[model samples]
Target: MFRNNNLSVCWRLVRREFRFHKGRNLMAVLSVALTMALFTVLSVIIQSLVGSVRDYCIHDMHATEEMYRQFLVSQLPELFPYFLSFIPVFVCGFLIIYNIFRIGVDADIRFYGKLITLGMTPRQVRVIWYGLALAVCGLGIPAGAALGIGGAVVFEHEILNFSKIPIGMIVSLKAIAAAGVLSLLTVFVSSFRPARITAGISPALAVRYMELSGFERKKEKNKFFPISIGTGNQVGEDDRKKRITPRRMAVYHLARSKRRTAVVIASLSLAFILLSCVYVQYISADHDIYLHFITFSDYTLSVEGAGADGANISRDLEPSLIRQVEALPGVSRKGALYKQEEWLDLGEHVYSRLTNYFESEGGWRLREMESDVYWTKAYENMRKNHTCIGMVYGIDSSYTELLARPEQLIDGTFDAELFAFGAYAIAEGVEGGGGQPNYQVGEQVEIGGRTFEIMALSIAPAYLRADNDSAESAFSLGLFIPEKSFRQLYPQRGIRELHLNVEEEERARVDRWLADYQNTKDPFLDIRSREALKETFDQQIRSGAAVGALMALTFGVIGIFNLANTLIAGLLSRSQEFAACLKLGMSDRQLLYMMIWEGVCEIGLVLAVVYPLALLAAGPGMYLYLTKVSNLWAYQYRFSIWPLLICTPIMLVAAAGIPFLCYRIIKRQSDTSMDPERPGAWS
Candidate 1:
C-alpha cells in the first residue's frame, strides 16, 4: 500500500511538470531528436564508407575472404573517424540537456518543498527528473531515426552532386541501435547532475526561493576609509547617486545562476572549438598532397606489367605512339621511366638480407608467385648465385626530378646532366623498413656485367616500383640511370611507361583518346591519371566535410537552442524580480538593455574560452591527421584563424539576437505594463 501510494504521487507530479512546462519539454524533445538524428545520419554514412574500405581491402589489397573479416578486426583505422565524432555529440548533448534540467529544478524548488512537507523522499524527486528525460526520449528517438535515414540518402546524392566519389546510402540496424543507445546514455548522464541538485534542496531554503539564485550568498559588511589615513577626513553626503543599472542587474542574474550559465557557455565554446578543429583537418587534407607524393604529372601510361605473355614495354609500347601522344593538341610536357629487368650479384651479405626479407615478408604469397615468367626466372636465379632481380629504369631529366625531390629522397645526389652521362643510382623503398642499401652513393655496382658509379639512393615513386618477393623485387634493388645510357643498354627496347601533363580542359579528350587507343591497339597497356587518383582523395576530404558539417550543424543549433532555453528559463523563473524592478522605476527600454547585456556577456565569455582551447585541441588534431591517420606525406601543419573568425561573427549575432528578441516576446505578453515615469514609482 505504501509503495503504491509513492508510485501514484510520482506519476502525478511528473505529469503536472510535463503539462505545465510545455515549451521547455518541447525544446527538450527537439534537442533529443536532433542529437539522435545527427548520430543516425553520421552512422549510416560512415557505415557505407567503411563498406567501401572493405571492398578496397578485399580487391585492391588482395586480402582473401577469410582474412577480410579478420582484417577489419585487426586493422580498424576505418572506424576511428566514426568513433571520433562521439566526443562532440555527447558533449553537446550533455550540456544542452543538463542546462534544461537545471532550469527545471530551479523553477520547481517551491513545489518540491511542498512535496517534502508531504513526506516524499529525495530519492523520489531524483526519479521524477529521470522520468522527465525518459518521457522526451520516447517522442524524440523514433522521429530522429526516420529523418536520419532519409538524411543519409539526401546527403549521398548531395555528395555526388559535387564530387566524383560515389557515396551509396547504407542503412544499418546496428548503426540506428547505436545512436539510440548513445542518445539514452547522454540523457541519463546529463540528468544525473540536475537530479542531484533537486535531491539536495532544503525544504526551508526552497520555501524562501525568490530570484533565479539557488544558494544564499553571505553578506559582506562595507568598510569606509579616509584619505591619507587621517581621522580628520569627514564623511559627507555631497550627492546621492543611484549606481545600480540594467547592465549591472544582468551581470547579477548571470552570476546567481552560475551553473546554468557555465553549461550554456561551455556548449557554445565546444561547438566553436569542434567546428574549428574540423576546418583545420579539412585544410590539412589537400588533394595536392597525393598528387605531389605520387607523380605530380597529369597522366601515366605503363606497359611494364604487360610481361604476362612475354610482351613488354620494349616489344609493345612503340616510340611512334610516344611521339603521337606528345603531338596531340593539349599535351604539355612529357616524361617516362624506361625499364628493363636486370639481375645483380650485390655480394653475399646483401643477398642474405634479401633472402631473409623475402622469407619473412613473403609468408605465403611468394610461394605462389606465378604472376609472370620473368619473376619466376628471377626468383630461380636469386636462389642460385645470390643474385637479386631488379629493374634498371632509365629516367630522363623529368623523371630525375622525382629522384631528387625532397619528399622522395632517401640519400645522395642526381644531376640530370651527370645522369645523362651514365650516372646511376640504386632505388630504395621509400616507406618500407627494408634493410640498408645494397650499394652506397658513389660506390660502384655491376649490372648487366657492366660497372657504374652509384649517384644516389632514392625511391622511384608511383608505378615504376612494385613489391618483390624472392624474384623481381623492384622494392629491394632497382636501378635508375640516364635514358641515353639506358638506350645503349637496351637499344631496341621501347619506353617502359609514358607520363605526361595535359591542359585541364583537354583532359577529357586525352582520356577518350587513351581509352580508344588502349582498347584497339594495345589492350594490355595500363592507364592511370591524376584526376582518377584525385577523386579518391577528394572523396575522403569531401566525405569528412559533409560529416563534419552535419555535426557542426547539430552542435551549432543545439548550443543556440540551449542558450535560448536557459535564457527563457531564467526570465520565466525570475519574473517576480523583473516585476519588482519595473515597479521600482525600471523602464521597458532598460529591461531590453539588461537582456542585451546578458547576451553580450554570454558571447564575451564564449570568445574568452573558445579560442585558447581550440588552439590546443586543433594542434593535436592536426598532428593526428597528418602523422597518424592520413597517408599523405606532403601535408604539413599550417595553422590558420580564418575558421574561428568565420564562426565567431555568426555566434555573436545569434547570441545577442536571441536574448534581445526573447525579451520583446516575453514583455509583449505581460498582462500589466508599468510606466517608469508614473508619479511615486520610486516608492
Candidate 2:
C-alpha cells in the first residue's frame, strides 16, 4: 500500500498551499527582509561608528588589549540608542513570522490530517512547514542585506558630511552574512512552534479543531442552511441573540486565538513604546540642548558693524527696535549688555595688580611673564598718561547665570539680586598674566567714578576675550555692572548685545519679524539664533534626535505592515466564516461593525499595554540607561508623552480602517462574494 510511502505528494501539496496563500507568504518574505535589513543596518552602525571612534576619538591610540576592552565598555552606552532602533524590527519579525506559520498550521490542519491518513508522518509535516519558511528566507535575505547596507551608506553619508565627521562609509561583507544567517536562524526558531503544533495534531484532534477555526459549518437543525459556517442554529434563537451575538462571536473569535491576538497587539504596542522612548530620551535631550558657544539665550542681536564704526552702527540698532523686540509676544526673557571699552587712570591699581601674579609665583609662569615689557608698558601708561586699559561690561540680571559656570567660578557666587544691588563681577585668570585684579569678594573696585564690591570672580571662557592673535594672549580686567548703572555711565552706547529666549512655537514668527527688520531697518544688526548654532552642534553628532526619528519611522512602517498582514490574512482565511454569518442573517453592515469592534479591541488592548510598558522603560529603565553613559550626561528622566499624540491617531485609523478597506476589496473583486478557490464557501 502507498499509505506508508507518499512523502513526495505531501511536499507538492504544501507547495501548492504556499502558492494558494501567496499574499501571506509575500508578507512573510517582507517581514524577513525588513528584519534582515534592520540587523544589517545595526551592524553597519556598530562597525562604522565604533571603528571610527576608536580610530579617531580614542585618547590612547597605542592602547593595550585591556585598554581597548575598556574603550569598548565605555562606548556601549553611546551605542544603546542604535541598539534601541532594532528592537521594534525584531518584535515585528517575531510576530509576523510566528503568526504566518501559526495561521498556516491552523488553516491547513485538516489538509495535514488528510496527508497523514494517506502516508505522511509528523516528521514530514514539520519538515514541510520548515521548508516553506526556508524558502521565504531564501528570497528575503539577499534583498534585505542590499537594502539595509545601501540605506546605511546613504544615511550615514548625509550624517557624516553634515557633522563633518571624517569617516567613510564601510560595508562589511561579514555583517551582511551574519544578518542573513541570523534572519535564517530567526525564521528557523520562529517556525518551530507552528511546526510542533502541526506535527502534534492527531487526525481526530484536527477534525475537532475545525470548529474552533471560526469557519466550521453550523450544526443547523435545518440542513437547508448548508452554507452556514460562522453562526449557529445549533443553539436556540434566544441563545443566538443572547450568547452568539456578533459582539460575543467576535470575542469568541479573538478568545480562541488569544495568543495570536496578543502577538498582534504586542507588536503594535512595541512601536509606540519605542516611540515614547525616543520621546523621553531623544526629544527631551534635544530640547535640553547645550551649546558652549551660544552666549546667553535663544537669539543674540548685536551690531555686525559695531567693531568698525561702533557708535554710528550702534545707532542703527535703534532703541525703538529694542522696545519692539522686548514687546514681541513670543519673546519670553530679554536683556541687554551695554559695553564701554575705556582706559581708566588706575595708576596705583595697575602697578599692584600687574605685579601681584608674577610675585606670587617663584618664577615666571610664562616666557612672556619673565620679561619686564608688560611691567614697562603698565608703569609707562600710568606714569605718562596716568591711565590703564580696562573694560566695563554692563549686564542685566539675566546674564549673571551665564557668567558663572561651575568650573569657571574661581571664587564667589553669581547672585542676581546681589548684582542688581550695585555689586560687580570681575573676570580673573589672565592667559599671559594681566587679567582681573587680585580682589577678594566684598572688596571694592573703581569703574568710571563708581565704587562697587566685587561679589564674584569668574574665569568663564565668555569673559576670557579669546583671540587668534598669539601676541594678544593676556585678558584685560573686565567688570560686569548692572545694565541701569552702565546706561547711566555710557548712555550713548544704546545696547551692545541683546539676548532673549523665544517661545518654541513662536521662533519662526520671531525669526520672520527679525528677517523683515534686518532687510529693511538694520542690515548690520548681526542677528544669531541658537537655533542655527544648535543645528551645527547637533550636526557634530549628526543628531541622536534624527536617529530617534528614523527609529520611530522605521518601526511605524513595520508595525503598519504587520498589522496589515495580520488583519488581511486573518480575514481572507475565514471567507467561509463570513458566508456562514450572512446565512445566519448577519447583514454586511453588522459584519463590518463586528470587524471594526475587533480592531477597536486590538487598539484598546495596545493602549492598555503600552502605557505601563513605556512608563517602565521611561522610569527605572531610562534611569539605568542614562546613568551608564557619559555623552548623555545632561539627559534626565523627562519622558515626553508627545509620541502618544502621534502614534495613537495613526493606530486608531489603521485599526478601524484596515478591516473596512480589506473587506470592501474582497467584496468588490468577487461578484458572488466567495473565494474563487473555495467553492460552496458562499453558496
Candidate 3:
C-alpha cells in the first residue's frame, strides 16, 4: 500500500509541476540547450587550436629528442590515472545549478498545499514529486549532452581539422559523455523531494496560514511607492512592525518559515567556483608558456640560416645581399654556428649525427659551447684540461671571484684558469675510449679523435645526456667547448645558427632588423624571435583551457538561471505572508532591500563553504594530474586575490537583482486596487 501510494504521489506531483509553469519549464530547457551548445562549440575550437600548436611544437621546433623523451617520461605516471580532476569541476557545476532548481522546489510547495487540500496523500505526494525531479533530470541530461557533443564535433571536424589527431576523437567523446551525465545528475538531485515535502505539510495549516508574496510584503511601503491599481495589498500593519533592521529583515525574508534562499546561494557559489577554477587554470597555463616573454631579461633572437649539409654559413646565406644587410643592423656583435650536414660511419652503422660548432683553441670542434659568465675557477681548470670532449665554452674569468667558495667549485666549479686556453675550454662529460674514471680536471679524455688532458672536472649545466618517455619534455644535453678552438674541429662547416643576447628593450627592434636582413639575402633562412614562438605556444594552451571551461559553463548557467526562475516563482506564492508584512508598514524599499539582503547572505554563506571545499578538492588533484601528465616538476599553486575580491561583489549584486526583479513583476500582477471593504469578495 505504501509503495502504491508513493507511486501515485510521484505522478501527481509531476503533473502539477508541468501544469504550474509550462512556459518556465520550456524556457529552462531552452537555456540548457543554449548553454550546452556554446560549451560544445568552444571546446572544439580550443582543442583544434591546441592540436595545431602541438604539431608545430613537436615537428617544426626541433627542440631536441632528449627534450621529447623527458616530456614523455614526465607524463608516463599519469597514463593509468583517470582524469579525476574533472570531478570537482562537475560537482561545483552541479552546486551552482542546484540552487536554481531549489527555486522551483519552493514554488512546488506553495502550490502543493492547494493540491493536498483537494485530496493527495502525503506518502503518494512525496513519491510523485521525487519521481518528477528524476524524470526531468533524466530527460535534461541526455538532451544537454547531445547538444554539447554535437556542437563540439561539428566544430572539430568541420571547422578545424584538429579532430584528425587520434586523441582528439577520444577527448571529444569524453567531453560529450561527461557533460551529459553531469547535467542529468544535477537536475535530478536538485528537483527530487522538493514537491513531495510540500505535499506532506499539514494541508489545514497551509490553508489557514497567510503566506508571503511579493505584493503582501510591500503594503506599507505601497504608500510611498504605491501599488498598481490592479495589485492587491494583503499585509496588515502589525506584521511590518516586527522587523526593522535591513539586515535582519532580509535574513528573515529569505529564511522565512521555509528557506530556499540558502539553497540558491549554495548553487551560485558552486558555479562561481567552477568558472573561476577553469579560468585560472587556463590563464595560468597560457602565462606559464609565455612566462619567458614576461620575465625575459636578455634580448634573445634565433637566427635561422641554411648549410650545404647540416651546417650553416654566412657565405652560403644566399644572394649575398643578406650579409650586407645584416652588417647594416643597429650595430652589435653577431656570430653564427653551423653544423654542416655530415654522415659519419661509426663502423657499425650510420646514425644521423648533428654536430654543432663550438670555438676551441685550434679552431672549431663538434661539441656545444657556452659562454660561462658565472665561474672563473672552473673556467681556469677547463683551460688546463684542453681535451674535455663533449663540451667547450667561453667564460669571463673575472666572475670566478663570485664563485670563491670551495663548495661552489665542488658543485659548480669556481675555477677560471680553464677559460684562458684557446679562448674556450672543455668542462666535463667525456672519457677515454675504453672507460676511464669519468674525466675530471686532472684527467685526460678523448673527443672528436683529439686527446687533451682535463684541467679541472666540474659540473656546469647539461648535467645528464639522455631521454625519458613522455610526449611533453624539455631536456638538453651536449659537450661544452671553447670558442677559439671551435675553428680547428669544424673549420669547413659554416655557421648555421646564432644565439644573440641583446638588450631586452631592443629585442623586437633587433629581430625586425635581422628578419629584414635574412629576407633580402635568402629565402631559405627563417628568423624567429622568442616572443613570437612563445605566443604560438601560449595560444595553444589557452585553447585547451577554454574547452574545459565551456563544458562547465554550459551546465552551470542552465542550472543557475532555472534556479533563479524557480526562486521567484516560490517567492510569489507566499502572497499572504507578504501581505502581513506589507500592512505592518514595511515599505517597498525595505521589502526589496530585505530581499536583496537575503540573496546576498545566502550567496555569501555558500561561497564561504564552497571556496574551501573547492580548494581542498582541486589543489591536490591538479598537482597530481599535472605531475603525472606533463614534464613539469610540480604544479605551482596560486590564488589571485583580485578575482575573488572582484567577483564576490558582482555575484552578490546579480543574485539580489534577479529576485528583486521577480518580486516587482509579481507585485505588479497582483490585484492591489480592491478596497478594504471588499475583503470577503474572494476570501
Candidate 4:
C-alpha cells in the first residue's frame, strides 16, 4: 500500500514537470523522430536498390539459370558488410539522444529533489522518468517509420523513370520493425544515466542549488605568464584585460561544463564533416567516370564491319568520305586512329625467365599443376607467356598531343616528334611487383619484327588491355607507333576510329550529317557526341548529388536541433547568474548581447575543431580513390568547398539565434527575478 502511494506521487510529479516544460519535451521527441526517419528511409532505399540489381543481374547478365542460382548463393556473405556500416550511425544517434536527455534531466534537478522531499523513493523516481521516456518514444518511433516509408516511395519514383531495369517501391515489414526496435533501445539506453542521476539528487542541495556558478568558481584555474624585468608589469596587464571581456566570459560559461560542450561540438561537427566528405566523393567519382569512358575528342565516329562484336571486324573509312566531312562548314580538326590486335614474341628466354619468376614468387601455389599435363602442355604454356596480345593504336603527332599531358609522364618527355619518328612511348604499368615496370626509357624492344626505342613513360590510358598470363602485367605494354610506320608494317590494316573537333554551335548539325552518312554509306558505323555521352550518364550524376544532399540535410537538421538544446540548457542552468547581472545594473540589452556572443563563440569553436578534423579524416579516402582510379584513367582530386561554405552561415545563424530566442522567452516568463535594491545584488 505504501509503495503504491509512492508510485502515485511520483507519477503526479512527472506529469507536472512535463506539462511545465512542454516545449523542451517536444523538442526531445522531434530529435529522436527525425533521426529514426532518416535511418529507415536510407535503409529502405538501399534494400530496394540491392533487389533491383540482383534481379537485373539474374535476368539480363547471367547466361543461364544455374549461374543465377549459384550467384545468389555466393552473395549471402555480402550482407555482413552492410550491417557493419550501420554501427557508426547507430552509435551517433545514441550519443545525440543521450546528451539531450542528460541535459533535460539536469535542467530539472531541483524539481526531482522536491519530489524526493515529498516522500518519494528513488526507485519510484527512476520508474517515473523511464516511463515518461518510453511514452515519448512510443509516439515518435511510429511517426518516424511512416515518414521513412513516404521518403522511400519518393526516392523510388525519382529513380524508376531513369533506370533501365524495372524498379518498384518495396517496403519491408521486417526492416520497419527493426528500425522501431532499435530506436526504442536507443531511447532506453540514453535515459538510463539521466534517470539514475535524477534519482540520486539530494533534497537539501537541489532546493538551494540556484546555478552552476559555484561549481565554476571552484573549478576555475589561474595562469601566470613570465615577463622580462624591464617590460614586467604592463605585459600581462593587456592580456588580462583582453581575456576578461563579455565575449570571453561567455566562452567561459561553455568551458565550465566541458563534457556537454564536447558532446554538442562533436554532434554538430560530425554532421558537417559527413556532408563535406559525401560531396567530395561525388565530385571525384563523377570526374573518374567521365575520364574513363569518354575519349579525348569533341566527337567520335567508329567504323566497323558487320559482326556480332562490331569492334572485332575493323572497317576502313573512305578517304573521299573523310575529305567531304572535313570540308563541311563546322569541322575544326580531324584525325584517324587505327586499332589492330597483334601478338608480339618476347623470345623463349624472356618467356622462361618470366615463368620462373612467377613460380619463385608462389603466384600459383594454391593451384594444383598435374605432372602428366605439364609436359603435354609445355609448348602451349610457353607460347602463352612468350606472346603479348594488345590493341596497337596508330596515331599522328596531333593525336599524341591530345593524350595525357607532360606532368602525367613519369619519365623522359612527351616528345610528339620523337613518337612520330618511330620511337614508342610506354604508359606506366598498373601497380604490381614494384611501383614501375622492369622496362624503362631508352630501352629497345622488338615489335612486329622491327626494333623501337622507348621514348617516354606516361600514366596509362583506359584503352590499354593487360595480358592475363603474366604475373606482373603492364597496362601500357601495348604498342603506340606512328601511322606511317603502322601502314608500312601492315598495309591491309584499315582505320577503325575517327576523331573530330567541331564548333559547339554546329554539333547538332554535324551529328545529323553523321547520321545521314551512316545511313547512306556504312550502316555498321557508330557515332557519338560528347554531349550525348554525358547525357547518357546524367541520371547517375543526379542520383549521386541527390543522395548526398539528402544525407546532409537530414544530419544537418539533427545537428541544429542539438545546438538549440545545448544553448537552452546552458542558459537555463545559469538563470541565477543572469539575474545577478541584471541587479548589478547590467541592462537587458547587454544581457541579450552577451548570450548572442556566447552562441557565436560556441559555433566558432566548433568550426575551428571540425574543419581540420574533417580534412584529416577525408584525406586517406581521397588518396585511395585517386590512386586506384589513376591507374585506369587520368584524374585529379578536386577539393569541394561549396558545401562547407554554404553550411557555415546557416550554422552560425542557428547558433546565435537559438540562444537569443531562448533568452527572450525566459525573460518573458519572469525567470530572472531581478531586484536592483536587494542587498548583495551588486556582489
Question: Which structure among the candidates has the greatest lDDT?
Answer: 1
Whose TM-score is greatest here? 1
Ranking by lDDT: 1, 2, 4, 3
lDDT of 2 at 399: 63
Q: What is the C-alpha RMSD of each candidate to the true structure, in Å?
A: 6.3, 12.0, 11.7, 8.9
Candidate 2 clash pair list: 229-580
lDDT of 3 by residue, 1-683 (tens): 22234364557657776667775666545544454454345444444444444453355443345544444444444432224434444454444444444455554554667766666677666666556555555555567667756666654533333122333533466555545555555555555545444655776656544434545555534332233322445646754444246576555555453444444445455555656565555544644434432322222223344333322223223424435444543534343332222111121110111111122333222111111111222223333442112322322232223223242233234335554464333333332132122334443444444555545444432111221111111111233344345556666544333334465666667767767756774555555455665665555555455555554555455445645654566556655655556655555566667666766676666568756756654565455555464554212444443445666676567678877886676466544642345433212
Of the pair 1 and 2, which is ahead by lDDT? Answer: 1
For all candidates, the clash counts are 1, 1, 108, 0
lDDT of 4 at 133: 77
Flag the better candidate by lDDT, 3 or 4.
4
lDDT of 4 at 149: 81
Query: What TM-score would you give candidate 3 relative to the actual structure?
Result: 0.60
Instruction: Please give the lDDT score at residue 326 for candidate 1.
Output: 87
- Please report, as a residue range, the 10-residue window in candidate 2 with the lowest summed lDDT: 466-475
- Colliding pairs, model 4: none
- What is the per-residue lDDT of model 4 for residues 1-683, given as tens digits with 9 covering 90 to 100? 25344567666766776677787778767867876786686567557655765665554443244544444445445434345535545665666788788787767778788878877778988988787777778778888888878876777554333455566566798778777877788788888998897788789987776435475656564422122212324545666554444565687777766667777777766677777766776566554457444566677766545334211244566777777878878786566777556565665554554455445555432122221122214334444565554446677665566554654466676666667777574534333442343245787666667787767666545432211222222211455678888888878877666778898888788888888989998786777677776765565555645654565676677777777878888887677777766664555776788899998988888888887876765566665666663342333556766777888898899888888787877686554355555554322
